[model samples]
Every structure is written in C-alpha cells, then in structure tokens.
Target: MLWFNPRHPSFFYYNTSTANLKSNYQVNTNGLIGQTTALQSVVSWNKTITKCRQNSQIIKAQKLFDKMPLKDIVSYNTILPGLNQAKNPEKVCQLFLEMERVGLKPNEYTLSMIFSAALNTELKLLVSQIHARTICLALNASVFVGSALMKAYADAGDGVGLGKVFNEIFNKDVSSWNALVSGYMELGRMHEAQKTFDTMPDKDVVSWTTLVNGYIRNKRINKARSIFNKITEKNVISWTVKINRYVQSERFVDALKMFVLMMRSDTMPNKFTYSSVLDACAGCCCLLVGQQVHSSIMKFGIPKDVVLSTSLVNMYAKCGDIDAAFSVFESVQRKNLASWNSMIGGYCRHGLGKRALEEFERMIKMGVKPDEVTFVNVLSACGHGGLVEEGEKHFDSTETKYGINAEVKHYACMVDLCGRAGQLDKAEKLIKEMPFEGDVVIWGALLGGCGHHSNTKLGELAAEAISRLKKDHPALFSTLTKIHGEKGARSTVVTLRKILNEKRFRKQEACSWVESPFHEM
Candidate 1:
C-alpha cells in the first residue's frame, strides 16, 4: 500500500513499483528556472505550506498564505483542506469570503469542503445561496462543482431538492445521479429511491453502491440481492456493502456465504468487512459461523478492535457461548465502556443478572464510568434479581454519582422495580412525576409488574399510558386487552381494540425499514 509521509522532509513516499516519478519530475524541471524572486517562490512557498500544516502552525501558515502574491486554485485547495484538518470551518468560510472579495473563485474541492462543514438543516438554503453566488460571480459552471452541490443537498436529506438540482445539470454523470439516489436512500424513501435507480441511464461502481445501500436501508433485502447478483464487476467496497446489508437484515448465513465466496475469489477482507461479518454471525445467533469468523479474524492477524471484540462477546453470549464471549472479552488489549456494557446487557438480557451486575461493578471499580446504557443493564439485573433497594440506589446515583440524568429507560426501570415489589402506589406516582410521558416500555414494565402483584388500579393507569405511547408494540395492545378483561371494563377493551385497529390500518402503506434503533441500553 502506498502511504503518504507528509511528516518526512520529502513529504511523500510509498512502496510504488517504480521510483520513476522522480525521473519525470527532473525532466519536467530541466529547462525551467527553479527559483526567481527571493520573496515569491512557488516551490518554496508550497514547501512552507506543507510544513506549516504538518507542525500545525495555524497562525504562521495564515500569515504566509496572505503574503503570497501570485496564487492559483492549487494554492487555495492546499490551505482549505488543511484548515478543515484544523477544524475551523467558520474560519474556512472567512477564507472563502476573502477569495471571493478578490477576483479569485472556488472550485469543486472548495465547495466540497463547504458542504462537509455545513449544518444539516441549513444546507439546502446555503447550497442555493452558493449557486446564486457562483452565477453572480460569473464563475464557470463545472461538473465537479455541480456534483459537489448535489452531494451537499443529498447529505441534507432533501432528496426532492437534490433531484431538482440533478435535473438542472445538462451533462450529468454517474456521480451526480449517485448523489441523488444516495440522498433518497438516506431519507428511507424507498419507492422514489427505486424510481431513481430504474431511471439512471448509465451505471458505475458508485451508482451500484448507492442503490445497493438504498435497497438495504429501505429493508428491501431481496432487491439488494438482485442488484448485487447483476453487478458486472465487484470491488472491496461492493463486497463490504452487500455483506453489510445481509448482516443488517439479520441474515448471517447469507453474509457468511458472501464472505467465503469473496475469500475463495482471492478478494481480501479489510477491518471493516471483518467487523461487519462477525457482527452478522453474532446477530443471527450462528455460533458455528461466529467461531469461524473469529478464527478468520485471528488468522488475518487483525488487532482486537473494541467494536469487533465486543460484537464477538455479545455474539457468544447471544448464541449460548458465554465462555467464548468471556474469553474474547478477556483477550482484548483495550476495552471501552461499550465493551463492558455489551457483555453486561447480554448477560442481563439472557437471565444472567448476577453476572451482569458483577461485571458492571467491576467496570466501575476499574475507573471506567458507567453510562446510562450501563445503568439499563444493571437495572435489568435488579429486575431479575428483585434487588429493589439496590436498584433504587443505582437509579438515584445516575444523576448523583455519574452526573448522567435519568432518562425514560431509567424511569421505566424504577417503575418496574417499584411495581414488582408491590409498591404500586409509588410506581403510579413516579410515572406521573416523570419529567416526560413515559414510553411504551415503561408502561409495559408497569403492566407486567401489576400482573405479578395483581394491582388492577395501577394496571388501568399503565393501560392509559400505553395507549398514549408513540410506537405500538404487541405487548401494549395485549396488556390493555388483558387488563380490561381482568377488571371487567368492557368499554375500555373495545376502545383499545379500535385504536389498535386504526393504527394497524391507517398508517401509510410503506414497509417499515426501521430495525428498532431504539434500545433500552
């Protein structure tokens, strides 16, 4: 792999097959004067700019940048990317304004930098302003600039707006179309997204990747596979994207098949692909596949990445291989809070509450701060173990010890603990006193606790809360029906049934691509 060494005096070096670029450089500079004026030398100034950036001499670089007399697009491009590296987009904007105040103009790279820094909501407006500004400035409308604009609008989630931009371009290329399609995919507008994919006159790697990702994002896995099968060429990116989709759709067998095919074809897997494949096996509870993937990752001598390692741990735990999960966890050189939390969440989720709580405490004692997610797993431990007093102490410490405020899940845990312990009155009071209306989970937890305690009054309150929740789940509907029947409230049951029917039927015809991004932990 060719690596750029900007830190070295030469500023660039790599294991290329040849050192002949130096020969060409010498030949190109043979007849040309190397240096002219003492104060203005392009080669010297360029070198200075490179060093200034390498050393992070922000103020000095800006000064040298200002003193330069003869400059070009290359000059501006150099400083803009480095300015972005320094993470002062606001100052980068100032530099663009400075370039504009003079007769100089922006190119595609400049606009791309602007797009990378823009606020998501304000993007379309700002991009339009930019187009207007460019027209008013009489800068040549370049395809690269137009493509960058299309990307900016797409990234902003304005697919229709991006389409409008796409249609305006006369000689649109694959990148232009890809941007619009990618935009639609990001917004989960699969129907219109499919339309864009069908109408594209020409296709490239980017075009396929965009559509493949869109189909997967929209949960049109079959369509994604159809597109993947039809591809005339494949690259590492295509492999990763397709494998990732299979993983995302919770189809571990398909992911494993693709990985074996890629490996047999002599296509090497990178860190990203390895992580995704392992994640897929873990998600589908394919212990055999999980073990094979783990062996491959090890054979490749890939470092134990925290995300990859955690995925293995959780996968092993999920697939009833707690020993493997613990072994993987202990094997990693470094561990993040997510590493600790995943195993804890897994343990609690699978009824290993005691182990989960022990791991949580151990994490805290090691100077690792427990986040809200950690608390959620610990609460699950409390729920399973019936440690009501300890659950309260941990819940209260969220704000008191960790300075993390109690969220809806935390409140849900408290309601579950209290209601299960036969403190129905306090649970009801806590639900009402919650800073916000609790979600379906909190209500469901309360309902389950009431069923255990046989508190019909609190059950009624939970049913009401469930009815008001945003997302409908099987549990809430069933709980309300059971609660109404248990209390002999025929009217409430009829009302609840009507609401559930309405929700099921009146919601849009679009298939939900959502995979419950919401998590208790």
Candidate 2:
C-alpha cells in the first residue's frame, strides 16, 4: 500500500514506470481518505482532458469529462477553455451552468472565458447574465475580464456598454486602448476613434494602422495618406494599404509613384501589392510600365502565383495585347474562375468574339464553373460579333443552368445585343419587362444602336430618358441633336436646345490615355 499526503499536493507523485501495478494508494490521514481521493481524481481528469484538448480531440475530452466521478473548480476551468477553443460556445455556457450548479466558484480566467464565448454568439441575454455575474462577484475590475467585456460590447455595437467596461478597467494596457480604438473604427466613428488614439499613452503600429484603415473606410483618402506619411516605421501592410487605396480612388499615377517609392525603400511587395500595382498600370493603359512590372514579378521568382498571373493577363489585355494576355492564360497551369474571366473579357474587348466564344465553350467543358462575370464577357462577345442566337441562348440560361440571377449589368448586355442586331422592338420590350429599373447604361446602349441605325424616333426617346438623369451631359445631348437634325426633327432639336439653355450644360473636354515610355529600373 502507498500513503498519500493530505496537506501538500506536491508530495504526491505516482511514477507508474516503477510502481507496482497491483499496489493500492490511500491518504495517510484516517478520515481524509475520501477528500484526498477526490482531489487526486480531479487532478488526473484535468491532465487527461488537457491532453485531449491540445490534440484537437475535444469530443474525446468532453467524453472523459462527462465520465469523471470527481470534479472541482480546476476540472470545470480546464474543460471550459477547450470548449471555447473548439468554437462550441453553447457547450461552454452549459458547462458554466454545471459549475454553478455544483457550487464551484469562478475565478478571473473562468469569467474571461465566459465573456469571450458570449461575444461571438447571438445570445444577448447571455452577455447580460455574464455582466451581472461579473458585477456580483466583483470580477468586473479584472483587467483581463474587463478587456474581454469591452470587446464583446464593441462587437454588439453597444457604445454605452463599451464605455462602462472601459471605465471599469482601472489599469488599462495597450490591448485595452486598442480595443476601444478598434471598436470606434468598426462603428465608423472616425472622430471618436482618432480622439481615443490621440489620448493613448503610447501608440504602437497597430494603433497607427487602425486609424489609417479607419480613414480609408470613411473615404477620407487624403487624411489616410497624411496619417500614413507620419508613420516613421512603416511595414508592408502600411505600404500595401496606401497603395491599394490609391488604386481604388482611381489615382493610378500616384499609385505607381508609391510603388516605385516602396521598391526604393527595400520594402518587398506581396501578391496583393503586385496585383494592385498591375491594376494601376492597366487602368492607365500603360503597356510599357506594365511590362516592366512583369519583369519585376519574374525577378521576384513568384511569376506562377495564380492571382498575380490573372492580374498580368488583365493588364496585358487592357493595354490591347490579346496575344500576350492569352499567352499568360495558357501559361497558368491551375487556373481559377478569375483567370478564365480575364481571358474572355480580353478577347471581347479586342473584338475577337469568335475566339472568346471558343474559350467560353472550353471553360464550360473543363467543369470549371463560370460566374456572372464569365457570362457578361460571353454575352458581350456574342453581341459584338452579331451572334444574336448565341447571345439569347446564354441570356436565357443564366438563371436556369447557372444559378446566377441576371443582374442589371447582364440585362444591359442583352439589350445591347438586341439593339446591335436590329431587334430594337425586342430590346425595348426586354427593358420594360426587366425585374429592375434600367440604368443610364441601358438607355445609352439603345441610343448608341439608334445612332448606328439612324432611328430618330427611338433615338429621341432614349435621349429623353438619359436627359432625366444626366441633365448636364452635353456630348449626349449634342449627339441626340445631330441625330434628330439629320432626320428632319427640327422640333426635337429646338426642344433639346431649350433644355440645354435652361440647365446651362457644357460639353466637357475629351480625356485621352497617353502612356509614356517605361524607364528600366
């Protein structure tokens, strides 16, 4: 028989490697045997449960927990964390209730787990109960639990709750400050977020980046740039965010300049960085700079990355090099849907409709699902090539065959197709019967087709529709006036001039793309 010490837990050590298998163990104290045995059982169960949890065997861990004959506060705490890690918040709450039922008092760790679990679930009343428990137990003053509560309130968009939690944290750390700033940013309260950031005793990279991202989210690009320049220690994320922002804002030239600066600073670009810069080149139709970027991509030894490959295809295609785009497409071995869409759109843009059609058929045959974008390109190809039958077939199959509801853009393509094929009646009927209202693009397509066919009656009607939205579009009005004048509709021309005079409309200067020669880096 082996004797166990009741007072000191560290005194008990069972070395199964050397101990006799048939030996019995008991507490040395006469009446404390049951208590010591229960303690030992709790420790053993906790060890096994923790091991199972670490190995991602939560189900096994729960089974062992359920089978344990003795459970203490430690047992409840161990299993609560495991359940939270497994993303079973509901089970975490259930286990918490069991802890309460058994009269086990919760520590700060347990309360933190409860708050963290409640933050993600849709159980509003759970948070309220947890908050009440924290108040009752006076655990609300704990920094760890307080921070968790702050984050939960932030996610719930309860400004009052967040403020209450923030004030409850008497000793705030960097994480506490970050949670408040991030919460404000998430809620789109830029002024409040900036204010909190300014009041922070020390600002880390995260603090700076959060404010920058907040400015970007609010569409204050200039302010975001201002804050970005103030960061002395900029990382790749800082550079990438600003670069992508310029691309999104359509400031392609500035975006290219920023990329050049980033390269000079020795800050390496990631796949997203390369993709955004390539998009900037494509937007400006800068073929020379685009090729230079391609060379840079190869030099970096990540030329085959699927996303970068797709961007390259898009860049080359938009710059009027369909062959280069096709070459890149063929080079990618594992092509995603985006890669196929880029290639098809490239062919459509360059007026190689028959080739685009062939690629579309091949895409479908390969069992790669084409999305709404693919069909947009496909319908455009058919429309440009005057393949009205093919266009109609694809248009009709959008909802039935592909599970993609035809959006307004797809309908606009169909209208352009019918209008281009001299089926104006079909186009008009389709527009009127569409589930949604036709935008300016749809009417503009009809007017372009009317101009091509010299149909003054429909042209006047389409121009009138456009005028309702774009009251000051001088070029569209000028085109309509010319069409009406040629068809001897002097009354319509006079009416257009009257509307133009009343609105004080002016014809804007034409903007053209002028790409400069690329200087080798």
Candidate 3:
C-alpha cells in the first residue's frame, strides 16, 4: 500500500522468518558488543560480512577476513555478497581483481557474485563466462552454488543460461528450485518459471509463493489465485502471498476475501498481510474499505511497526480522505522516515504541495536525513506550486551543503520549472549540465512547460530528445503526440500512432509505485 516506507528494514515487522543471506557477518566491534569470534568457518562468515556491510563498515569486515587463520573459497565469497548488497556490484569486480592480485582461487561463489551484479544485457556475457569458468575450475557445484548460478542467469534475461545451469544439477534442493523460479518470475518469464516449478520434487511455501508472486508481479492475478487455491496447507506466507497479490493487483475485494479465508483456515495474517490489504484498499481508492482495514489494524494491534502505520496513512490519503490520513499519522508515537515520506507524498498527490513542503521541513527539523527520493517530490512540488526560488535553493543545497550529487530527476524538475517560467535557455543549459542521461520524463517535462508557455522551438528540441531514448516508453510517446498535436504537427502524430500500432501496447498502470518510486517525486 505504501509506495515508500523509509523506515529501517529492522523496524518493519515482516511476516517471513529471518533469512541469513549468503556471505553474512556479525557486528561486535563496539565495546558494548560481545565476543569477537572472527568468523572462522565459511558456514556463517557471510552473515558477519552482511552485518559489516549493513553498518557501512565493510572495511572492518575486510580486515577480519584478511586475518582469518584459514581463508576458504567462502572467505573470498563472503566479501562479494557484501559488495553485492551495497548495490555497488562493481565493487564485487574490484574485489575479484583484488582476489586475483592476492593469488586466491576464484570459486563458484566468486563468479556468482559477478553474475549477480550484472544487469540486463551485461548479464548475458557474464553468465556465459561464469558458466564456462565453473567447468574450467573443475569445481564441485553444490546445490547452493548452482542455485546462485541459475539466479544470476535468470536475472540477466538469459533463459538459455538459466535452463542450462538448472538442467545440469543432478540433485536439486528447494532453494535451487526457488532461485530459478524466482529468477524467472523477476524477468517476467512466467511460462518458463511455471514449467520449472511443475517439476520441483517437493513444494514448500517459498515454491508456491514464488509462483504466486510471479503471477502477481506479472499482473497475472487469475493464474496466481488458481495456484493459491490449490495450496492445501496455508501458512503466514501463503496468506501474505494471496493478500500481497490482490493488494498489488488492486483487487481489494479478493484480498479481503482471502484475508477472511486465512482467518477461517486458522492462519493468522501478519504485518505484511495487513499492509497489503490496506494497500488493496488504497488501490481501490475506496474510503470505506480502508476504514474497515484500519479498524482491523486497531483490533489486532501491531503497536511498534512503523510500516503498517505508514501504510494506513497512505491508504487514507489514496482513498481521498486526507483528514483520516493525518489523524492516523498524528496517532503514531514512534514516527520514522517512511512515516514522513508517505504523508508528504499523500499531501502532494492531493494538491497540497505546500503542505507537503511543510511536512518535509518538519522531517528535517526533526533531524531525519532526507534521502534522494525525498528531494524528488519536494522538487516536483516546487515546480507545480511555483516555488521557483525555493526549488533552486533546495536543488543547490543537495550538492553544496549535503554533498549528495544532483541526479537528473532534480535537474529535470529545475528545467521544468524554468521552462514553465519562460526560461527556455536555462532549461536547455541545465539539461546539458546533467551528468546522467536525461530521461524522456525530463525532456517531456520541459516540453510540457514549453508548450504551456508557447515556446515551439524548445518544444521541437524536447521532441528530438524524446525520440532519442534507446527504449520507447509509451507515456513519452503520448506526451510527444500531445505536444505535436498542439503545435499543429498532425502528420507527426499520425506517424507516432503508426509506429505505436506495430507493437501491442498496454498502458502500464499510470501509477508509478516508486513515493517519487514509493515516495520520491
């Protein structure tokens, strides 16, 4: 339900059990911390590494890794997962280079990290290289290792590699199957994922949920529900699975039905269930459903959870009841960053951009550091509400004061603002100054303001930029069409429509879940 809950993951009471992501580490650096058993075994050293990476103290973990009496393949393996978690997967490569420099043998885990880090196109090349290296190293690929490999290939959009590595495994475990299935689901490969799942020797909650999640994620609700109904024994995950699907799919009635069914089945819905059901209400844009869910949340009080509270606020806001949203927000005793972000987005969405600004300022005054996402929406508000000077000051502050580099979205907002104010040259100059590739959204934003200001020349340039995007985004195409039509370019509109007709186009739900992607702009 919440597009963005900025609260720390630890503060959120999720339904699932604590998973020790591979290559974890424990943090006992502080004096208040307990014994320092520099994880000797590879078995759980990864957990320790994870702790270090989480604390932004990977350097300490690195030191511990260096001092370990006997560093196994898992030792090197441990570092890569930490880097992978940081989202700086390039660091995984750097670590690999370091490994090569140190003369340590690169194991399957090492290669898997590289594969995991590769996104989209790069995944294809890396997966092949990793698969080949697996054979070259003569490494005995364990189920875990093989699963990781399948996961990498699946993530890369290489179904070929996914099938190849998956087929090679003689004795597959639940995790291996889950990995492959999850990968397929992630890449929207439902057909392949389903086929692989059908053959899984044993099915667990993870297996069933992965399929349901795949269907839900791919917007295949009917198939997901069909499989969900067949799940004989439902756990929290099972309930959450269906509830999550309905919430995401905006099927409020179905989610509520499933929740009731879960209670009847003697499976208690967890925080995720509550959050998702609230989300379904939000999606439905029905105030009554949200009120009902709110009462339910009250009856089964999850007092300390920041996420659920945030979800409630979002549900109320989305259901066209900002009064209720603020009422619940005010009731929250332990408000966190997500709480603020949700309320801000809700305000912004409801044409209360000024109020959103006030909330963001409240967050800053409360000493909560705003992430990039916070600035995006605030910048958007600046443009929409005509707070040009305020917008520029905040934009400049991101780099000059906070030391956070200005991303292109911020640049887009500034450009849009200036263009709306008839400062076309300033918008173009800002576009040129942007470090990242400007998206169609940015160019289109400028073009929109240009059109509003009747600046046809800049509009043409914005159209050109929109045309240059490597991949076609439907909304961008639509915006260009509108601009062209307004500027009397009916021929271009016809051409755009023809180009669009060649492809089966589905307008992805206009709802960009992301606050500015769950609470940013």
Q: Which of the numbered candidates is closest to the native, going by highest lDDT?
A: 2
Residue-level lDDT for 206 in candidate 1: 74
Q: List residue ranges in candidate 2 displaced over 4 A.
A: 1-188, 490-521
Query: For residues 351-467, could you state the per-residue lDDT of candidate 3 as single tens digits?
Result: 787999999998899877676777877887777687888988999888787667888767777887777677778888888878877776677677666766666677778778776
The better-scoring model by lDDT among 1 and 2 is 2
Residue-wise C-alpha lDDT for candidate 2, range 248-313, written one tens digit per residue: 878899889999999999999888888999999998999999999999888987646889899999
- Evaluate all candidate structures by whole-model CA lDDT and list the values in order: 0.72, 0.79, 0.72
**Candidate 1 lDDT (Cα, 0 to 1):** 0.72
How good is model 3 by TM-score? 0.67
lDDT per residue (tens digit) for residues 218-259 in model 1 = 888888888887887888889988898888777878888898
RMSD of each: 11.1, 11.2, 11.4
